[model samples]
Target: MVKWDTLARPKEFGELGFLDTRAMNTVLLAKRTSHIDGCEDSPCIKILEKKKVLERNFFRTSHRGGSQFWQGLQEVKCWYERGRGCTVNCGERVKFRKDVWLGDCALKTSFPYLYQIYRERQCSVADAWERDWSLEFRRNLGQEEMVEWADLSGRLE
Candidate 1:
């Protein structure tokens, strides 16, 4: 019998360029998840709704033990969250610093080192305004950080 791996490789690499069934399945399912935001009536979504598995936020839900199909949906959700993240409209659900609500990139991604070091800055955007940042760090930023912060601040304002 021919090796499956050999057939799965690209034609450019001297192989048959046959599509990987498992990978194709994953891509198709992930594509379907995009329709989750639409009006498409799916049995899988109904099951999740019945189970109360994140009626709003799919990322908040977990895949502990349940349907394998549900698990696959969660995997697609993981891909979505990591890529698109979330936008700050009311600033209620979106997490400040912890989520990518500010701009094109996440605060944590833009300033990975700063995010790890800053303890008081991690909170929901709503809470930050309510508390008025009593414990907000007033420490002077490094020249590079100041540049980065300025760039980020400019976009938000």
Candidate 2:
């Protein structure tokens, strides 16, 4: 008898082209969680609402308590969060350094040294904008650092 692992392999690998059920389940759950924001009519969402699971942010909500399906949904939220990104509008809801608003990655990742010296790491986009983009740092920028700062400044504009 062929082992399940062999049966689950791709046809090109000289085995059956059946999908691994666990991996398929994970992919489906990730897909569901990724689109949960727009699926207001989903029965799973309704169940979460009935169970008071929608009281907090879906990504921030605890996965510790709920039905089997709810637990499964929560388990895939990390994948959802990783793939999701924010687009700044009002700016109040978007985090300046921690969120992926300005570019492909978070500002902290883009400018690690500047982020290290930044005073208000948790400040919102609105807070930084209101400050005229003159964010306070722990110390003055050195000559070499000034060049780096200029790059960051140019990106902001």
Candidate 3:
């Protein structure tokens, strides 16, 4: 009997590549997500944006009492944020700590201590730039922190 785990493995390793239902759902709903603002002529999108969901950060915004379709899209948005890292083409939309912009890893994941002390954790890259990369802390970093900062600073572009 073929093991269930083996059957679900990626196609690269000779196992059947099972369809990723969550990923598929995310893609299907992404149509509505993308059209939220860009297509200004859309009445539905305009209406939705007027409400609590889309006025600001759509990814970080909560969608507690929306319709099933909207709730599904919100879930997809959460999944996308959790599973992927982004390359910075423009600093406008990407969150400074939450995105993988500086180098290989997300700043939050790569530097938890710094993130904990960060004054502008939710700021975007553009926002950070406006503030002059001034990530404040309560006290001076210790020797280990200095080493870590040096390493990460070198890696940061």
Candidate 4:
């Protein structure tokens, strides 16, 4: 069985991608106790119930629209910030630098075969960082100067 942590990582082994932690947490919560029937005795259900109670109280005291509920639903923010170890203030600004070549990054070096596959697909460095490289591009790059081009690119991830 695949470990949840492994699945939580960016799709590819070598890519510089990261899973959003908040999203992962929500998934964990939702999947905490899977059963044939939708029983409410699961840990996830209990936590969700507690969350609902807190939200109700919060809304009653303050005019907030249960921001935590919305935030919990939109797990992107927490995932990006905690998963990547990025500063919470401006995590969105931390994207894979396009000009960087995969060959030079330590993450790529650790997973050379995967990175090579990514380069063969002629994927942009940014795409590689996001683990979005396409198999079609990989096939095309086998006949092109993709490796060289990726190597020569000035930026590093």
Candidate 5:
């Protein structure tokens, strides 16, 4: 079995790295059609859906003594909370720094490998020209030709 956790860390942390939900969702869709390996209707997908936490607009509280407390709300963008699909409130905001935020879903640190796999597969498909060319060249010429030109090429079967 593939170690998915190892695939979902930040690149600098030495893993494949985390990716946004849009890319992750694409991988889930393609997995249904057998395009990728290691994950298929996996538990991690459900875990991600169930535990998706969205950061919302921050409400800042300042004490009389100059101490500041930042409170983040659960964004109103979750489908379960809103009873709709892909609405603007689906938890896309995240506070990255003291007050700065990101307008995208950040996967929890635990599932970095799964996210990495998703990202890698999406990138590969998006850049399929080279992959397709290599596959075709191998099919037409020979395995020897493929070996000479490709770095790590091989058939699924």
Candidate 6:
């Protein structure tokens, strides 16, 4: 008997090509979420915005108090996030430390020590750049932290 997984493989892979509904639904939802912000003319988006359901960035929104559809969007957001990278232009939408704009990974991952002491962790890239990338920390830096700070600054330069 042919395995279900084998049957699901692509025709190019020498198996019967079967579309996986779960993966397709996940991809479709992810695509929808990714483009929803840009679709300003969409009536559904307009309604959600009017209701204040989309006050915050859709991906960052919590599922609490939202509908099952909102919860589903939240659930499928990870798929989009995993396959996405941000390009900082005005930087209004991209999170400074959390987004993968400057490199392959996030600044928080690149500079863990600085992130731990950073006061404005939620600030966007535009805000950070406006402050000349000189972010406020919770406390004074020691010698090691000073070196890291220098390295981070050098990257910006």
lDDT of each: 0.67, 0.79, 0.70, 0.39, 0.30, 0.80
Q: What is the lDDT of residue 100 in candidate 3?
A: 66
TM-score of each: 0.66, 0.68, 0.65, 0.20, 0.16, 0.73
Clash pairs detected, candidate 6: none
| Candidate 5 Cα errors over 4 Å, as ranges | 1-37, 53-126, 130-157
User: Which residue pairs collide, candidate 4?
Assistant: 20-79, 21-79, 100-155, 120-138, 121-137, 121-138
What overall lDDT, based on C-alpha atoms, would model 3 receive against the true structure? 0.70
Worst 10 residues of 1 by lDDT: 132-141
For model 4, the superposed segments whose C-alpha errors exceed 4 Å read 1-14, 32-37, 43-157
The TM-score measured for candidate 4 stands at: 0.20
Residue-level lDDT of model 3, residues 11-114, one tens digit each, is 99998998767667778887666565245568766677776556765676786878888798787775556545565555777898887677666887787776
Instruction: Residues 1-157, candidate 6: write the lDDT tens digits.
Output: 9877888899999989998777888877787786774566787677778978898777677777788767777888766765567878799888898877877778887888878888987899999889888789999987777887898898898
**For residues 37-137, could you state the per-residue lDDT of candidate 5 as single tens digits?**
12334663344335432121212212123111101111211221122112222223221111111122322122233333232321222143335522222
Residue 17 error, candidate 5, Å: 34
Please write out the lDDT profile of model 1 over residues 61-135, one tens digit for every residue.
677766787788777766665556564666776667766666676777887645555566647777765765322
**Predicted model with the maximum TM-score:** 6
C-alpha lDDT of residue 131 in model 6: 85
Instruction: Return the TM-score for candidate 6, rounded to 2 decimals.
Output: 0.73
List clashing residue pairs in candidate 2: none
5 Cα displacement, candidate 3 (Å)? 8.7
